[model samples]
Target: MANTSVQTEPGTRRPGVLQAVLLLAGSCMPVLGSVLLTPILPQLSAEFGGAPGGEILVPMVVAIPALMIALFAPFAGQIVDRLGRKKLLIIAMFAYTLVGIAPAFLDTLPAILATRVGVGITEAAIMTVCTTLIVDYWHEPERRAKYLGLQTIVTTLAATAFIAIGGAAGAAGWRTPFWIYLAAAIIAVPMIFLLWEPNKADPTDSHARAPKVPIPWRRIAMPLIVGLFGGFTFYVLVIEASYLLVDAGVAPTDTPTIGGIAALASLATAAGGFTFTRIAKVGVNRILPVAFALQAVGMLIIWFVGGVPGVAVGAIVGGAGSGLLLPSMLTWAVGSTRFEERGRVTGLWTAAFFFGQFLTPIIMGAITAAVGSLPVAVGVVGIACAVAAILLGFGLRKSNMAPAEEVTATV
Candidate 1:
């Protein structure tokens, strides 16, 4: 039977500010855990004698989790719906902490890979559940849009900070970042007490135990297109920016410095997200095409520009575009769905989004290997993103979906 137990309200009940902060904190930990190890991948390769075609291994550490998340996220939606968002989040936090630390003790590549796989599982659980929880907590369209923007900002800031710190720490010893996971893990402890499960699920009510909502593929089509192109642009930049810098005469050790500079793109994204609430009155559909155009222009700059200044320009433009794109796409998707099916819709959207991220490294790695220059491969990927953006622009126009009502309730 179709599930009728889920709440139909467009926004979450008034969970206090403290509880909301705890929930956002819980969401941030897994993202930090997932990317914190990126800077140390080369060190791991050398220590473990990873193979020559092994550049893929470095990204695999990050991409594998995304791949697994894409594979299992649909099922995870049902699990969260059956259980509760907080319950899965706690379990995911525990798994993230343990798996994040396991690699430090391992001497072999296979063992490290195994631990990464565990990290992937934990990431899938955390992401799928936390997104659902956010929907539950913020029902107002405008408030939810702002919160989603904040969420993206926090995620980008965490990723940027951890990557920079991880690179510096790796210079001291590769194991140092893993220790940081301990701190992220302990956060779950306080979260356990602070988070309250919604009372909508009555234990005495058997009718509440309804079947899970099926995946909402139809409503998600536009978001998936935007996500795929947006993810492609972002991941391609991340995977190949260091190489591009290196090719232009930057040293390998200086790669992190270049990466940090490129990370300013995320900052631009955050800025765009923050401003979107005010500008959303301009219309999401109208704004979306502009976002895609900015990203494409950034890619063009990266493709044609040969120096640090060019890369910086590209990052800022692309970042702003992405920042505007993600929240708008998410708001649009959620607006199209009923509250009861929000989890399933979000799960599918995230899965598709991450699937593009998962594929970027593998595809770029193969192209890099075949062509022997990372910059050229990334340029190709950029071109592809540009094409996709153009295609998605037309698709959104043709769909003619109505804008979602803005929610105004405070946390």
Candidate 2:
């Protein structure tokens, strides 16, 4: 059931357009920082003198920041709720900008890894706070949906652009792309000037604040489960794409081209998200199952189809499904929570999302190592999604939560 006390104004009634843009920019920086590093892993490994399990190190570098984000998201939320979103966002962006540039100067693998962890921590702060602020600004379900889609679109587009840029820079020198983070500081400067504090007064300002209601774990459990599955699917698609292409006989030189093809599939996700507002009239409940089904089918296609085109098709299908599912799930999850607890609930949601992302590489790598082939490994992920879809189907059927329309109507 949706929490009745969290006053949800119509999302169309949001306060500031500039603030929204700035928040979106802040949210997208970490994504850009992460994806831009994808093509540079081999170069970094070679430069460092191959350590044990060095081949996995690059992935670890990419995934670990997400792992830390998952681990610390709750704390990040508390800090935001207590300290205010704008202040925390500024701190995080500054940290992100600095840490992003650290690798250019640091030569050791450990030093780079340490900096990545710092970057992840800052990312958690920015992502959690930004999400809370989005909820604060946009109250109408449909409009909120559109903004969320826009957020996904911007991050996807930025990541795609940065991947190409990173690869080019990596070809020149491995450390060059880290300098890209400097742009985040530049992007955040205007955001800091424009973004307003949330209307909800900071609770820390007064000791006489009313006693808080306990968060309802039972209400949020189903959405959290869905988020976890979504994250897992996302990571599986991202981590396995390159290997899936390589196994199908594509040369290493062709990996970036293939990866770009897969990454381009994210555009479908953006489109799907945009399409979701229209689809909601038919019912999000009806749409969600179909979305998960598409994801399952996409994963199945990747498992069965091996070449570059196959990978591209699979990515498009799965990415579209992911694009659809994420906004729907987030809307459901946030709608279910009280306003006072939105930050914490969002934190948990972020944690679940990153946890699934964090687990994908390790699990898929283990499966690939054990089975000795990419197809078998991807097949395992397919099976996992199939199982998750079945569970989601059951959850949807049993769920008694308010319809999104009702939620919007109240707003």
Candidate 3:
């Protein structure tokens, strides 16, 4: 169901290693924005603690970028489909580098927070275009699955590294970590030379003369719904692993132990990403349930079995599920659109996924307070995953997640 439009390849070149490498690396910019500032949140709060609304605004530095992606990516998608992909992506990446690094030099808390908003808006464009181009470049199902799955693996691994980088950089000063934003500019260099606009139609082609159609919102609705859930489960460990460790008796001051276990869990997520293509041939219907199930099993382990060992083992189990969860959702969401609407499709899916991520902590916080125990709250989410897995695996037919059912409607 991937776009099969006959593209006039950029000169004689086809998308190869350098293209894949750049796109995958580009995909990580959003991950850097999301997790890189997390380890330094406490430090930021202390520095800006005296400012009005500092308590709420300081944490927004990490969360607001994602919230922006959720709110604005659909508009970014509109721009990509209307103008050009590579042009917008290159501009956003460069903008991201400048805006991303500006916070490091700003003195006031509100000004710093304003820069973070700028970071999110640029991220909305960068993340959407990077993903849309991946689908554009790789037309083969196997090739598309491989690279899409790699997006998850690479970004998941990057999250772990960025957390470590943020923590290490924070030691110098809270603002020191913002210098890390310079990497976006570095990644943008080859992008100008190596990347091409994938769907530019020839001026005289008959197909080009045909009017375009709207996004297949009806077809994608199910996939995006499932994607929202996948995104929610995807971050359970990244957000809650520390709390799980603490509940299991690890000291709040034991940074080393906490970080070690989190790293191990991240590896488990990467392993799931690594194995995704091997199992991707089974299709999204089968993959969805298993991904959610593995996470459910891991969370259940942590719920029933108390102690450091339980937390460690459960995190590994849940982490692996998260690794597989993302690519499956992406593949599901994007398979039905054509070249003209690919950007819009990818953008909607991105919005759904990140909106789910933005909602995770807020929803989890409510659940935890309602239950009055972290373990019980986690147990409730685990149960929901179990139910979802069963329903998705058996309740839905293969055609329900049909990548093969490509929409051919044209104006």
Candidate 4:
């Protein structure tokens, strides 16, 4: 059901290495705001303490973007469908750079948080468009899988670098990391001349028209449901690992130690992402159980052992599984969808995953409160994930008619 009719050769003969890299670079931009300011939360908290709810609001500057993506990505997806992917992407990147840098000059914490929301809105457009274009640019299943995997790998790696950069920039001043937003301008330049709309109506030919397709609600239902949990599992370690480290006796101010742990986890995630294409051969049904099991085991290790080494080991194991989770979800959501619907579907996929991410802390907090232990709460979520994986494997096995049906039918 992959859309094979579109003329992808907009300006070039076909998508080349440069085009693939450009799209991957776009994917990386969405995650930049996630951890780019983590190292400086303390500084922000101190500077804004006089403001009402500053303790709570100051830290949100980093977290609000993902929440915004969760809330607004679906709308962005609708825009991508009605307008065009290239236009939205170009605008989002430019807007991201502007809003991202707004914090550097703004004096109030609320004002900066407002800019962060703008950052998220633009990122919602960017991530959805980037992912949609990946499917559009490549119709072949193997190539699609390869690019998706590469996209995840590149983004995870960039996140690690951004964390370090954030730390270095944070040392100069709380707002210094905001300067990195300017890099988007450099990326936008290449996009202007190189990025092309694949499913767009031709400007030169009045007769040329793209066919419209209805959204396949039934086809995407399972993938969205799975993606929600997949996102939660993907982010559990990143959001809570620092606190786990502190619980293990590392000083709260030991940013280096905590950052190092995060970097190591991201490396594990990159390793997992690199394996996506190879693991894909087994089918997504078989893959999820193992991925979730790895996550379960990693969480259990951190829960029982409770230390830096334990947390690191858990992160490595969990990170590997998380690495494959996203590409698998993307493949499932779009494997049976047409090119025309890819943008809207991709937006839903982005929303599902990010909403899961936004919900993780609140859900995990509830579990922790109920159990009165953070490690145990993480462990409980891990157990739930493992159970879900097992049930999904069995259900998919029965529902999938053939090997090829695995990705489209039940995955």
* CA RMSD per model (angstroms): 5.4, 5.3, 4.9, 4.5
The number of the candidate with the highest TM-score is: 4
For all candidates in order, the CA lDDT equals 0.67, 0.72, 0.78, 0.78
Residues 286-356, model 2: lDDT tens digits: 66777787777887787787676777788788878877777677777775455567788888888888887
Put down candidate 3 lDDT per residue, 1-411, tens digits, no spaces. 212233345333356677888888899999899777665655665678779877556656776787788889999999988998999999999999998999888999888878888998899999999988887776556677778888888987987787777766766777887899899999999999888775445332112334567888788888888878777777666667766776788654454466567777777887888777667776777778899999999989888996899888998999999888887878888754577888888988888888787777777778889999777777788898999999898866646565432211111
lDDT at position 258, candidate 1? 53
lDDT of 4 by residue, 1-411 (tens): 222223445542356666787889989998888777776666675689779977556656766787899888888888987887898899889999999999999998889989999999999999999988777776566677778778888998998888777766776778889999987878988988877876444432221254777878877888889888888878788777766877788765566666777777888788877787667767877777777887888898888877888888988888887887777777777655666677788888888888887777677777889999888888998898789778887887876521454343211
If scored against the real structure, what TM-score would every candidate get? 0.86, 0.88, 0.87, 0.89
Q: Which wins on lDDT, candidate 1 or candidate 2?
A: 2
lDDT of 2 at 70: 88
lDDT of 4 at 171: 67
Measured by C-alpha RMSD in angstroms, how accurate is candidate 2? 5.3
lDDT of 3 at 69: 88
- Looking at model 4, residue 402 earns an lDDT score of 19
lDDT value, candidate 4, whole model: 0.78
In model 3, which runs have C-alpha deviations exceeding 4 angstroms? 1-12, 42-59, 106-110, 202-211, 246-257, 403-411
- Residue pairs of candidate 1 with colliding backbone atoms: 10-139, 11-139, 12-139, 140-407, 141-407, 142-407
lDDT of 2 at 208: 18
